[model samples]
Each structure stands twice: as structure tokens, then as C-alpha cells.
Target: MADTTADGVERRLPTDEARELLALVRDIAHREIAPHAAEEEAAGRFPRALFALLSRSGLLGLPYDPEYGGGGQPYEVYLQVLEELAAARLTVGLGVSVHTLSCHALAGFGTEEQRAAHLPAMLGGGLLGAYCLSEPSAGSDAAALRTRAVREADGGWVIDGTKAWITHGGIADFCTVMARTGGPGARGVTAFLVPGDAPGLSAAPPERKMGMKGSPTAQLHFDGVRVGGDRLLGAEGQGFAIALDALDSGRLGIAACAVGLAQAALDAAVSYARERRQFGRPIGDFQGLRFLLADMATAVEAGRALYLEAARLRDEGRAFGRCAAMAKLFCTDAVMRVTTDAVQVLGGYGYTADFPVERYLREAKMLQIVEGTNQIQRVVIARHLVGPESR
Candidate 1:
């Protein structure tokens, strides 16, 4: 509503359209998403209808081309939209990110015919998507995944393996799955677009999560799941490259979510301090609390700026992987620290479900782990700067 981010920091949108889009996102977040977030998360309920609403609203395809039903927004604008959604509820924000990641392989590498046939539906037809890369044995080391996809007599592929920690594992309409197609290691990996209802495909019960309970994180079992040649995304050995490239952008999305979460926590702490009383005066009068809020505000602003910078690099068609990794690392880690302080600022109430700060506190840990862990992010940055270590 104000010409500012979720926090009070002024935002400089690229155009009037981008500003209006942000305002729309803000309005939807406040009225539709934030109100039900606490209740649904406590109940571990996924908001499927809301996702459909987002799809219809064109929020799901913000960064893609408008020719195929997308909004054609730049990465900078898209990342800010994610920030607003995340500030209201991490499940919705991160869900949209994962969906965008799922679309990357095909949108970036598929043939014109393939894009014509599928991209429009994926972008706006309310078809929720999941990304399957992680496995039981492979988490940070994604290149070590063992899911297999063997070409069959009909020229279709049979996918057989389990994908662990999949968001929207059970309910997605489509999935972008990376599986082994040749020899061992990353070179053997291939990306395939699989229909959710493919034969023998099944999902394990959702993992009981620390936070983001409203988002289904489960192991998806692709037991002889079959798809036509049309499903193959990119070349046979190009899947790993595609996956990594997608992560470079997805990491920025995660960074934006982290900043939003941190901003929400800071807002809660600031509000609590102002209204909360002690020693016959408002707690805001205390210098001890004042400095803590200042630090939290600073961290939120810094994280937001870092992620937006990376998004701008991506939008400019520049090499942004190093910056993306840095943003992911700093923003996720900063949210963890800032949210912890927010909980402390609320004293006893912060630890309880009575306050959203505790929820934000729990959600912060997941960001450090998802979309390549913060540890892996540092490795990415180091490798970008110093090259990989000798084997």
C-alpha cells in the first residue's frame, strides 16, 4: 500500500505495471493468504484452491513469455512477488518457486512444438507441478541420484526410482524428474516431464515436517512410470546442466522467501515491542529492545537487497550463479538469526503458537536446507571464485 516493501524500505519497481502487480500481490496476500496461514499450517492442510487462484491470477507464470499465457515479468519483479507471498505464508511462496523450477527444463530447452503443446497449460491451466531431484541417498550431492529411466520398445521411457523431499509430491499434476539414462554420475542424468497419473507412480505419506507442514514434502515413487518421447526435456546428457541452471534461478527465489519471512518476523517483533508494556511504560521505550529491532530491520533490508541484485543480474542475461548462491546463503542464514531474535523479543508468547513469530522461527530453518543447503551454497560460491578442489 505504501511505496515500500513488506518492511518500510522503499522499493524501486521498474515500471508502473510492476508497481501495480506488486500492489495486487500485496492485497491478495493480506486478504486471502495471510488470514488462513496460521490455521491451515497448524492443521497441516495444503491450500490447493489458493494455488488454483494464483494460477488464474497469472502469478504462477510471472517470469515466462506472455505468448504462452505468462505475465512476461522480469526476474526482478517476479522475485518481489515471491517476497510478498512469502511474507504472508512460506508454503504459498515456496510452492510457486518449486513450480517455476519444474517448468525451467522444458521452457528453456524443449522444442517449439513441445512448448506449444504444454507450456501454456503448465503456466496457467491450474496445473500444479513438482520438481523431483533429491533422493534418499542424494540430497546435497544431487549428481549422485540413482533414479533410472530406460527407453522401451515403444520409444517411451520407463522411470523407476524414489524421489525424496519432493514438494507437492502427491498432488501435483505434472513433474519434472531427473533420472539416470546412461552411465553413472551426472552425465547419465536426463530430465523428463512425467504425468502424475502415470502407471505405477505412487507417493509415500508426507513427511512430518518441522515447518511448512501445509506444503506436502514426501517421497515420490516412480515405479515403472512411463512417458512418451515427447516428455524428454533437453538432450540426454544435458539434464544435470539444466537442473543446476534452474537452481541458480530457484536459489534467488528462495532468497526472496527468506527475506520476506525475516521481514514478517521483524514486523511482529516491532509491533509487539510497541504495544507490550513493562515497568509502567511501553517496552518500545527501552533502549535494549530498540537496538535489537534496529539490527533485525537492517538484516531484512540487506537480505532483500542481496536477492534483488541477483535477480537483476539474471534478468540482464548475465552470469548470476555466484551472486545467487551468495544471496541464498546470506538471506537464509540471516532469517534464522533474525527470527530467533524476534521470538526472544516477544518473550514467552513467541515460543507459543499464539504468535506467528514462532511459525516464522520454525520456517527459517527449512530455507537453510532447501534449494541446495546453505553449506552447498558456500561451496558453489567458493567454486565459482577459486575453482574446484583437486580430487
Candidate 2:
């Protein structure tokens, strides 16, 4: 029953600090982010400066240890902040999520020296990061990644591979890259925190996406990209496990972003319903649109609660991978429905870019595909229920 602003849901935050932090985030979202989202998105401009602002605000590292210059907020609070940011602009919210995902490896597994050396600048010093795991062929089958990292005679590493679907691809200050170092398969993969300006690093042009045009997504290439031995994130041959753990948390971020998008669509639909009139009365007075609005609201509320439940489980140190998958699947699917319904509520007007629902609908589609597709999410959940597929 955490109090939400747009829908009037009640919130009981864990601490005064969290509540204040959320309030600050909401204010920033409303004032600084939302007003320019449409124009910026249409221009296909990435809001790198805004991310720097978030870093300065201590928002980029909320879920990590405070000792490493993070805010030390639990998933409960961090996800809610993402919800608010996403409601304003999917690019900003999802950008934060991707950045957080990029930082997960070192934060969760890096040695004290490694963390102390790099984390302070990463979390709050305005350095944007990207996660590099998905490859052109791998997709959901991460173990099938072909990117190779060979050990140098000096015990350093030289990576050679292309990482596809990378957010902030060309612009990131750092990348958490996974490359096969041993034999073929998951165990052979290892993680490294490579500088964005590393030797032989390059990026392809950003993909022309259907939505979230303000956030860049592209392929990154590492051609003999060199990194010192100190750049290794965790033990060698442990990258897949780390990647899976990061995805579990990243899924929750997606869920929160999905709920935010749905809420915004619901809000717009409701407002339009009350204002737009037919037969000399408000359209909302009609039973058909009224029921649709009701259903949309209910779906949004349910999605929000679902993600929060999963977040709470994560905060309590429970096994939440199954629940995270569920939340990602449900919330993203719900957003697609809610946004489509929002367009229906607006009728012809919704189809036009003059309104935001069309954009919301397009953006909702991306959630279904990222952080593992909805199909992949279902597979993850099914494995938890029935045990790792019949094969």
C-alpha cells in the first residue's frame, strides 16, 4: 500500500530518508524530465546530461552499498524511483536501469580494492555505464555467446567480439563486458569492466528503434580491446552466474518502468474521457469507455503491486528470480494492453503524435523485448515451477 501520487495509492516507506528521496525524484521527474520528453524523443537525442544530473543527485547508484558511494536504498525504494522517472520518460528511466545493470557485477562481486578504486566515480561521479552481454547470436541463450577474451602473456586480457543491443553503446563511459575465456559454454565466460575508451573499442550506429528514440541502443565492437588484470569483475568462469543474477534485478527495474508507462497512459485516458464529449455529454459517462478505463486502472494497480511484492522479496534476501520473471512478464504485458486501450480511449486523436498515448504504446512494446523477452521470462518462471524444462 505504498502511497502513489498519480493513482492515489497509499505508500508506507521503510524510512523517512526513502520517502524524502522519492519525493525529490518525483519533483525532478515532473519538473525537469516530463516537460521535454516528447520533443527530445522526436529529435532522437540521447539525454546524457540528464543522466549526469541523476548521478549528481545520487540516483544512479541507489541500490548498491553506500560505502561504495551508492545511496544504499533497497530495491523497494530504487524501483519506485525508476517508476517515477519512467512515467515521465521511458528513455530516462530505462537508461538508469541499464546503467544500474552495468554496475551490478563489480558492486556485487568485486574485491574491496576494486570497488574503492572505481565505484566512487561510477556511481556518483557522472560516469555513464553500459552492460555488454547480449550478442547477435546469443540473445536469450547467453551461454552461446561467441565473444572471446584471450589472456595476454602479461596476465591481462584482450577481448574480441561484438555485443549487440547495447544501451548507451557509443556514449557509455564504461562497459561491463562478458567474453568467453575458457572452453565453449557458460563456464568459459568471464566478466571485465572495460573503459569505454579502451584500445580498439568501437560502436556501430544506433539502431532506429520504434520508441525510446531518446535512448541509444546499438552494437559495440571490441577488436583486441585490452584490459588490465585488475579489471576482472569476479572470479574467472563466473560471468554467466553473475549475468543471471544481474538480470533478475534488472527485470524488476523493467517491471517498475512498465507500471509507470501504464499509469501515465491510464491517466491520459481518464482525463480525455472526462473532457471529450459525445451526445452532449462527457464520453466517460458512457458505459463502454468507462469500463475500459476501469479495467486499465485495475491492470496498472495490479502490475504495480506485483512488482513491489517482488521487490520486497528481494529486499528480504529471498530467492526472487522466479518472482522477478513473473513481474517482468506481467507488467510488460499489462503495459502493452493498457497503452493500446489508451489509444482506443482517445479514438482518432490517440493515433496522432499530438497526444502522448501513441508514444506510450510504442514504448510499451520495447519492454516486452528487453531485459530478456517476455517469452524468456515465461521460460524462467516455468523452470522455477516445474524444474528446468522437461529436456
Candidate 3:
């Protein structure tokens, strides 16, 4: 059974250990993350040291196999930990999520020898990772990706392509990349584990964004980057399948981050409303503002519940792609609404950098676009409900 807090939110953690883990995450967030979030973000500094701390604390590999130095926690527990981190800083939360996504291909489909050789170092050895699936022309239609990997006479592969919108692109130690190996379309693709410093691999400058500037997003170019056959993650022509499978879980991670962001915005608004004087009393005492707070709180709770439901399904080894899409679509939409309302609650202060709501609003917009756009999510859900559309 889970526990209920004074804030009226019920955490449905399955074990006491999970509860303790959440408490530890909160302690870290309050002590180490929150205090530096605004400053680091404003300065556009990536907190590599903070990621090292998380890795040392066994947080960077929370949901993988314990044999590989992972914590072996379920997705439910892992995601709640993400929520706590995201509440402190979205850069940290989303960075962790992307790192985990980068590990999915090898962890799930690699040969035993490959897993034994790479999983431990990748999972908990202080090495960060990036996922390379989206390209300049293949954001929504991922099947149309044009990156090519040609096999060499020596059983090596030489890859050539550009991957765009890659989180942690320049800083990651490794990348799980997908590229064309055969014909056109998804069936031609294959997955590989590429070292970030491999010759011919380089990152373009990071994109200047509205928020989360502390996290780098850039385009990665594979200019004839070569890797041995041993680096192939799964069977040929299976890269698209592997990529979609990873995104199903990655969407849940994004959903958890969105809920955390919304919760943070709500907390900021409520705290300000309770102390800020309006006319003669606290602004929170007014029914109009109070109702707004109520709605924001409700949305946060609802989004959390939705993601947890999808996570539980994932942990049960059930098919959860549609649920994951729904959670991502709804939670991100909720964050945009809640953050905007939080700005309204703070009036002019929210619009300024003095308050974090403005930044929250900016960050919330990216969640709706990443993993998959909300429109793409709707198409996925509709396909699940009624079969694929006619060609």
C-alpha cells in the first residue's frame, strides 16, 4: 500500500523501500538541485557534476537489471523518482530519461556477450548516453529516416547521416543510433551502439531554446563513422521495431516529467498566493484565485495518476504503447495549461525571471513536441482503437 501526505496526494508505492527512495530523492532535490536550477539554467550550464552525483548514488540506472549495476526498481518507482527530480529541475529529469532511453536497445535485444561487455559500464559507470533516431527529415515519420550504414568487406560498418534534436548530443559518452542498412523505409534500418568519440562523429552547436538551457540539444553527424559488426544491437531490419519499443517507455518518462513540472509550477503559485498581499488579505483567500489553485492541483494529480497507470502496465509486461501515448499527450497538455495558469496566479512577477513560472511555461511547450507530437500521439491512439488507416 502507498501513503497519503498532508497535501492530499496519495503516493501508491508498492513497498516501503520505494517510499524511502522517494524520500532520498526529495532530500537530494531540495539540497542539491533546486537551489542551483534557476542560476544554472540562466547561465546555460550543463550540470555534468550533478549527473555524476546521480550516477554515484545509483540513480542513473534505476530500472535496469541489477546484475548490470542497476537498482532493478520497477518503472513505477523509477518514474516517481523522475518526478521528484523534475520538480527540482527539468534538465536533470529529462536528461536522466534520455540516458535511460539510450540504453534500451542494447539492454533489451543485444546478445549475452554484448550485454555482459557493455551494460555495467553503460548503466552505472558514470557514462551518459544519447539516443539517435530523429533526423532532419524524420521527426514524425521516423520510418523515413535517411541515415545510411554500409557494411565493409572486413565485417565492419561505416555509417553516414545526421541525427537532429538529440538531447545530450555533444556530452554523451555513447549513443544508440539507428541508420538505414538495406532498402528504403523502416525495414531497411538497423540499430548500433556507437561510441560518442568515434572518429567522424561530431556534434553541431546546441540549439538555443526558450528554457531548459542547461540541457544541450544538438544535431549529431556520422560522417563515415565505422564500427565492428559486434556493435550491432539487434538483428538487421529490426531497428525500427527497437526504436518504437524504446519510445513507448520513453513517452512514460516524458509524462512523468510533465507532471513534475506542473506540480512545481502549482506549488510556486500556491506559495506566492498564500503570502502575497492583495487589497487587505492574502490573495489565496480570494475564491477566484483559490479555484484556480484547485484546478491546477487537480490537473497535476490527474496527470500523475495517468502516467502511473501506464507505468504499472509496463512493469506487468503488458502492451502499453497506446496508454503511454495517451499519458504523454495528456500530461504534456496539462503542464502547458497549469503552467500558464500559474503565471496568471503570480500576475506580472510570473512573467519575469524573478519567478520560475515563466520558465516552466517555456519548458512545458517542448514536452508536447518531443518523444512524439500530441497530434502524432492522437494518430497512434486512433490506430490502436480502430486499425490502421487505408493507404
Candidates' C-alpha lDDT: 0.93, 0.94, 0.95
lDDT of 2 by residue, 1-391 (tens): 2555655867667988988898999999988999999999999998888888999999999999999899999999999999999999999999999999999999998999999999999999999999999999999998999999999999999999999999999999999999999998999999999999998999999999999998989999999999999999899999999999999999999999999999899999999999998999999999989899989989988998889899999999999999999999999999999999999999999999999999999999999999999999988988888887655
Best by lDDT: 3
Judged by whole-model lDDT over C-alpha atoms, candidate 3 comes out at 0.95
TM-score of 2: 0.98
What are the per-residue Cα lDDT tens digits for candidate 3 across 1-391?
7766445578999899888888888888999999999999999999999999999888999999998888999999999999989999999999999999999999999999999999899888999999999999999999999999999999999999999999998999999999999999889999999999999999999999988899999999999999999999999999999999999999999999999999999989999999999799999999999999999999999999999999999999998999999999999999999999999999999999999999999999999999999999999999999999999
Better of 1 and 2 by lDDT: 2
TM-score of each: 0.98, 0.98, 0.99
lDDT of 3 at 34: 98
Which residue pairs show backbone clashes in model 3? none
For model 2, give the 10-residue run with minimal summed lDDT.
1-10
